[model samples]
Target: MTIRRTVKRVIDGDTFEVARKIQGTNRIRIAGLNAPDSNQKGYSEAKNRLRRLISSKQVTIVPVGRSYNRLVA
Candidate 1:
């Protein structure tokens, strides 16, 4: 399912939440970018950039348990 909403918050460099209810959820985490814990460089910026890419827009998620296994977008 695809949901439409704006970014409500940015957490770290790999997590963010959307505004309102989106398919009954709001969190979105990109799989490709991995960091060495919270102290990793550009961790926060990476997440912020991702938030900009997806926030307040329609997104279609093809859920994958091993989301980090692939490199497609």
Candidate 2:
């Protein structure tokens, strides 16, 4: 199912958190994105780009699966 929620936080380039009021989960992983890890080069740039794109914005989430505790979309 697809849902819309405001972006609460950007965890990294490919992962983020939505509003807590939504059901199921708030954490979400962007599917198919292989962004730089925390210790790697360009990590901050990638994360910041994502933050600029989605932070505090309402986004559509189409969940495909679950990884760790985050919903993959």
Candidate 3:
């Protein structure tokens, strides 16, 4: 299913939070993106880039699966 919502926060390079009416806040993981982890180099850069690209913007999500608490899309 395709879901459209405003991005509420950037969790990292490949994950972000979106507002949901019933769920409160939902975390989304960009499918196929292998961004660096917090301990790795370029982690901040990747996260900043992602944040700049989608911060406060309404984005379309097509969830493919779930990883922990995040919806992979």
Candidate 4:
């Protein structure tokens, strides 16, 4: 399913938060890839780049499923 919402936060390089009209907010993870963690050398750059790309913008999410609670898109 495709969902349209405003990106509220970037949790990391491949994960972010989205706020929806009725559903409140949900954390989402990009599928089929991995990025450096916060303690890793490239983490800051990766996250910063991702944040610049999507911060405060409306985005579409196509969820594949859930990992714990986060939607994998």
The TM-scores, one per candidate, come to 0.50, 0.92, 0.95, 0.91
lDDT for 4 in candidate 2 is 91
* Model 2 accuracy (lDDT, Cα): 0.92
lDDT (CA) for every model shown?
A: 0.55, 0.92, 0.96, 0.92
Off by over 4 Å in 2: 22-25
RMSD of each: 5.1, 1.9, 0.9, 1.2
Tens-digit lDDT string for candidate 4 (1-73)? 7999899999999999999688778999999869999998899998999999999999988889899689999
List, residue by residue over 1-73, the lDDT tens digit for candidate 3: 8999999999999999999967789999999999999999999999999999999999999989999888999
Model 1 regions lying over 4 Å from their true place:
1-8, 18-26, 35-37, 66-73
**Candidate 1 at 54: error in angstroms?**
1.4
Model 4 / residue 50 / CA error / Å: 0.4
Error of 2 at 53 (Å): 0.3
Looking at candidate 2, the ten consecutive residues that score lowest on lDDT are: 18-27
| Pairs that clash in candidate 1 | 6-56
Query: Residue 5 lDDT in model 3?
Result: 96
Q: Sorted on TM-score, highest at the top, how do the candidates line up?
A: 3, 2, 4, 1
